[model samples]
Target: MSGNKIVAIIIVGLVHLLVGYALVTGLAYSATKKIIERVTTVDIDEPEPEKTEEPPPPPPDEAPPPPIVAPPPPININVAPPPVTVVDRPPPPAPVIPIARPAPPAPPAPPPAVSKARGVEPKGQSRWAARIQENYPARAVRSGTEGTVGVSVTVGPDGKVAACRVSSSSGSDVLDEAACDGMQRYARFDPALDDAGNPTSASWSTRIVYKLN
Candidate 1:
């Protein structure tokens, strides 16, 4: 019994030892396996932290759209007025006229006294003629003296002598002197008239007479 007990105890102890050894071996093996796994499996390149792709930043909030622009309103303009029209009016009619006139009467016939003697002077002479007669050269003719002479005389429109002059003498020297003296101092004549009753010019002749006083 005593040997059996001791053997049992030794067996028991061997079992315990075996158990501890087994536990220790198991632990060691587990530890070794973990180390090997850690060493072998360790990525020499560390996995980059999961790269989360940043979603594209949300599109920037659209700025409120600028207020819509509107086209300018069409401008209104005034139209010009039309031109004025001109109308032409006709002229008025002219007035009528009346006229009347009378005829003139005929002229009277001339008297017969005017036709009798165209060149004769009336018997009665003017006062100027009598003054001329009184101045005649009577003394020169009473002595039988005879003379011829030419005389220039101015006759007026009334047949009166305006002036008298002696210009030349006849061959009979005495007669010439007497005639010139008579004519220069004494002359008588009548006046003349034109058809229009106006005084006009005429010529007259007279014989120079030397008579006794």
Candidate 2:
């Protein structure tokens, strides 16, 4: 029996709480509606959209003033040219220039002198030896008896004896000297020539043979 009493109390408390929540929710909704109605009134006016009118275009410009016409160029009539007067003008004098003549070539130099010692032919088949013998004969020497001496001579272009030396000794100085002396008197030769055909100096050599008996 006590358990039945406690259950009845719990059900009665739930029903009272539900009734309080419903009353509070209805009051809050009514207040919100009243505030909305006051803020948005039916007497408030809305603005109308503005009408836009386009301006008419300016009157068309009078056709551009006609282009100014340029005056025509003056007529060009050519007058007859004045008579041409020909003044006499003497032609310029010709220039006088002296012509130059080339100088005459110098006379060619004389042919080169030849050696007197080179061209001579001995007098005989044994002319060279004969000549030497005639000049020196046999002569006494440091050695027991003297014999003939032979020599060779080199002659230069100036007819001068360049060199004379003993070729075969006669064991005698005197004989050698004699042979050389002969050459100095008898040798003669023609000068040689250069590429230009001009005579050039030259040298020549010859042997002088000497004999005894």
Alpha-carbon TM-score of each model against the true structure: 0.29, 0.31
RMSD for each model, in Å, please?
38.7, 12.6
List clashing residue pairs in candidate 1. 146-174, 146-175, 147-174, 147-175, 147-176, 148-175, 148-176, 158-191, 159-190, 159-191
Candidate 1: how large is its RMSD?
38.7
lDDT string for model 1 (141-166, tens) is: 45554443565665576565566555
Q: How many clashing pairs does model 1 include? A: 10
* Most accurate candidate by lDDT: 2
The 0-to-1 C-alpha lDDT of every candidate, in the order given, reads: 0.59, 0.63
Tell me the tens digit of each residue's lDDT in model 2 across 119-139: 422233354445544654433
What's the TM for model 1? Answer: 0.29
